[model samples]
Target chain A: MEFTLIKPLFGGFLLGLAALSLLFFNGRVAGVSGILGGFLSFKKHDTLWRFAFLAGLVTGGVLLLGTFPETLNFTLKSSPPAVMLAGLLVGIGTRIGSGCTSGHGVCGIGRLSQRSMIAVVVFLSSGIAAAVSIDLIFGGEI
Target chain B: MGLLMIFLSGVLFALGLGISGMTQPEKIVSFLNVVGEWDPSLIFVMLGASMTYLTGYGFILKRSKPILAESFSLPTRRDIDPPLVFGSLLFGLGWGLVGFCPGPALVALVTGYDSVLIFVLAMGFGMYFFEGIDSRFQRGVDGGAA
Candidate 1:
């Protein structure tokens, strides 16, 4: 297999393993949005673990930058304004929707949750539509 | 021990995202733009992840309780509510607009790009904004019923 394909597959396996470990040991879903949201809420006795996980996430990113800089290499396609808007939408949407790619797309689908199946389909289709629209608006710049 | 496992899980998850190319906004946009130059790499990522998770999840569910926690804390809501649909739609638009979801966006912060920082801050604001509105709305409804 090509390196491109192998890399993603291996990375995906790691993601699955991470989710599994969280569930097996901590009995919590490794949903990034949920973890962050809960931390922000300051629920009693609930902040420490979330902080630890987020700190670990940032640490992992630091490690990747140090060891395999190539993996973290990429450029932003959208302008600053567009990027900011996108971030806002993602934040609100994930909060109201109760999940994101990791939570719904990975764990939810793995467990055969019907709601997650619908969510994945909705997000994927809408995402495609939005990308196409942005491409057209930007004359293929985005 | 539970916290340790969760922290390690976060680390592994971030590493996976970095290695899988999910940290790349352009790649995610290209993946979403199926009509354009499509990169099918994300499909493999999801496939590998879901399959691995599904297989392991089956075994994990068989256990009466998690090793570190008293019981599993999984989501139980099954209704296909309006929030699920509309929120996902909005999220997709944002994701398609910038190709950065919550996890990869956070993972990409190590790059120290100004854009990533801006995006994350805005996202936090958005989440906080929604929580405020949602709580007020809920309170209003409760007051009316009472």
Candidate 2:
């Protein structure tokens, strides 16, 4: 394991803290898809909080980057275009499911919601299948 | 009360990603690749997450009383269904293709990967795809889940 338990522990810990804070003030869950999805709204009035949240997200990453320069290696063996297309499809899936895996898998699961559980299961199984199929059909073999 | 707990959860989850190496797209890509120059980052991440999970969930559970709230809500459904199967398939397909999912994808934006924009746009469409005039209600539902 190139990574360690402390990483996830701290990461999850931060996520939980973020969730708690949102709940305290906004009575909200910190699902990124929903927050990011809301940013397109033209109503400047309604978007302020969403914008703020999204801003915080970006800011958090920026802070991390500044703190940990070693964390920013951006090389992938696959083509960028291919990955982008994949991301496009994922966006569609997140839309169809009414939530992303994190919304469902992490926060939803953390809260123990039926929908989130179902969503997580679907996300995990589908990801595993996709991994297998990609290896089999394309010989990409991940 | 609920809002407070949720916010705390988000911070914790993000922290997990940051620490687990899941927040790192390269690690994720390597994990997905698994065959050629496979990156062992995934193992470390899972281990990192599992170790954290050991105390994390239990600690929350033991609290019996969550901060700012009476209790924590657990997942309602126990069965796997069609949506579960199909959605998982789609999500997986997308992840394999992009090497990015919701969690890592958002965090990865710090790197300014141009592809993150495309992914985020598609994700927006995905979130709104289910509703029409009742969209407000749906957004709330979606928002609540997040």
Over the stretch A1-142, how does candidate 2's per-residue lDDT look in tens digits?
2645555545555555555555444544556666666555434654655666666655556656777655545554446566656766676566555466556655566666677667766765666566556666776633
Worst 10 residues of 1 chain B by lDDT: B137-146
Q: List the residue pairs that clash in candidate 1.
A: none
Candidate 2: count of backbone clashes, pairs at least 3 residues apart or interchain: 67
Provide the overall lDDT of each model, using Cα atoms, as 2-decimal numbers: 0.83, 0.57
DockQ of each: 0.59, 0.35
Fraction of true contacts kept, per model? 0.74, 0.40
**Alpha-carbon TM-score of each model against the true structure:** 0.94, 0.71
Q: Which stretches of candidate 1 lie over 4 Å from their true place?
A: A1-3, B139-146
State residue A111's C-alpha deviation in candidate 1, in Å. Answer: 0.7
Q: Which candidate is the best by TM-score?
A: 1
Where does candidate 2 stray beyond 4 Å?
A41-46, A139-142, B1-16, B29-85, B125-144
State which docking tier applies to candidate 2: acceptable
Instruction: For residue A93, give model 1's deviation from the true position in Å.
Output: 0.5
- Which has the greatest lDDT? 1
lDDT of 1 by residue, B1-146 (tens): 77777888889999998888888888888899877888888898998888899999989989999998789888887778888888889989999998999999898999999989999999988877876887788721110000
